[model samples]
Target: MEVFALVGPLYRRVQRKIELDTARQGLSVGLRAVLDLLREHGPMTVPQMGRAQSISRQFVQRMVNDGAANGLVEAVPNPAHARSSLIRLTDAGRAAIEAAVAREHALLREAAGDLTTADVDTCVRVLGRMLRLFEDVDVNGQAVS
Candidate 1:
């Protein structure tokens, strides 16, 4: 219980650092969030994607349009809706995401050079558990439905 008092803030700090670094690389946090959503869910409508990330549909649509223009995402015909299109990451988008992930991992490794692999693994596990807990809490709190 006492350990969580330290871990929570430290975990948030790490997240903030990663977000700052990603922002410096010309990827807005929202864009990264959109990319990550697409990567995990494969393809989805703007509304669906927005809901998944707790973003507004208008915002997601704008981001998807920008991504499509940049060749990072493409529009697919939606079977369920005649007018709505599904957003999917293009090959270029996947490559960019891979590059970003590699850069992030490199940064983490440099920052945690003193930590052994086992130590890093434990940190990851703890953080992952915390993330799951946060997600459940959010849902329970009506942050998502």
Candidate 2:
């Protein structure tokens, strides 16, 4: 329970840090997520991204729209789906994400001084388990009980 209580605050703090970092590169958090996903997983539909991030399809669509408007991403034909075009990174998008990731990595490496591999591994294991515990929750957030 103590760990659970700490999770929310920790998440908020980390998210705020990321938001500040992304802003320097002229990216909103949603756009940064969309770009990161496309870069990591290749082209995908908005629904796929929504599912991947456990967010709403409509929200992902909005982010994709913004990316398209900025020439960061473009819609290409999806052979499997007649409609829902795949969103892909433009050359500029690739460059932007790479630079952003490089900057983040540089900052992340600075945090390694005080933590051991085992400590980080334990945190990952605990967080992963906690997340999976919510997998059975309904969309309305009701527990199975």
Candidate 3:
């Protein structure tokens, strides 16, 4: 119970760090995910990207639209869709994500400097379990993980 009590605040603090890092990089978390997904998987439709990232398709669509407007991504004709489009990272988008990832990694290493590799791995595993639990209960509950 005491550990549970500490978890919320600690999670929020970590979330805040991510929010701050995203803001400092001038990218929202959603946009960053889109860019990262594109960088890793080549090109994909917004729906495909959303599925890969576990974000809502509508939300992913909006991010792609925003990125398109900002010159980070462009709409390419998707023959399979005929209406919607596929998104691919521009050179600028790839560069932006690379920079943001480098900074985020540096921040994470600095913040977790006291922890051993095993400790970090354990933390990640715990968080993954928690997320899966939340997902399993999402339909019966009202919360975001």
Winner by lDDT: 2
Look at candidate 1 and tell me the lDDT of residue 140: 32
Off-target runs (Cα >4 Å) in candidate 1 are 1-4, 110-145
What are the RMSD figures for all models against the true structure? 3.3, 2.4, 3.6
lDDT of 1 by residue, 7-91 (tens): 7797799778768976787676667777878888898999998778766899988888778877888999999997988888999
Worst 10 residues of 1 by lDDT: 136-145
Give one digit per residue, the lDDT tens place, for model 2 in 1-145. Answer: 8888998897798788889999987899999999999999999999999988878999999999999999999999999999889999999999988888888789879978999999999999998998798887755576645
Using all chains and alpha carbons, the TM-scores for the candidates as numbered come to 0.70, 0.87, 0.73
| lDDT, model 2, position 108 | 76
Model 1, 86: alpha-carbon shift in Å?
A: 0.7
Best TM-score goes to which candidate?
A: 2
Error of 3 at 65 (Å): 1.5
Q: Which candidate, 1 or 3, has the higher TM-score? A: 3
Candidate 3 lDDT, tens digit per residue, 33-123?
8888998898899888876766689999999888888789988899788887788999889898889888878877777767898997997
lDDT scores for all predictions?
0.79, 0.90, 0.81
Best-to-worst order by lDDT is 2, 3, 1
Q: Is candidate 1 or candidate 3 better by lDDT?
A: 3
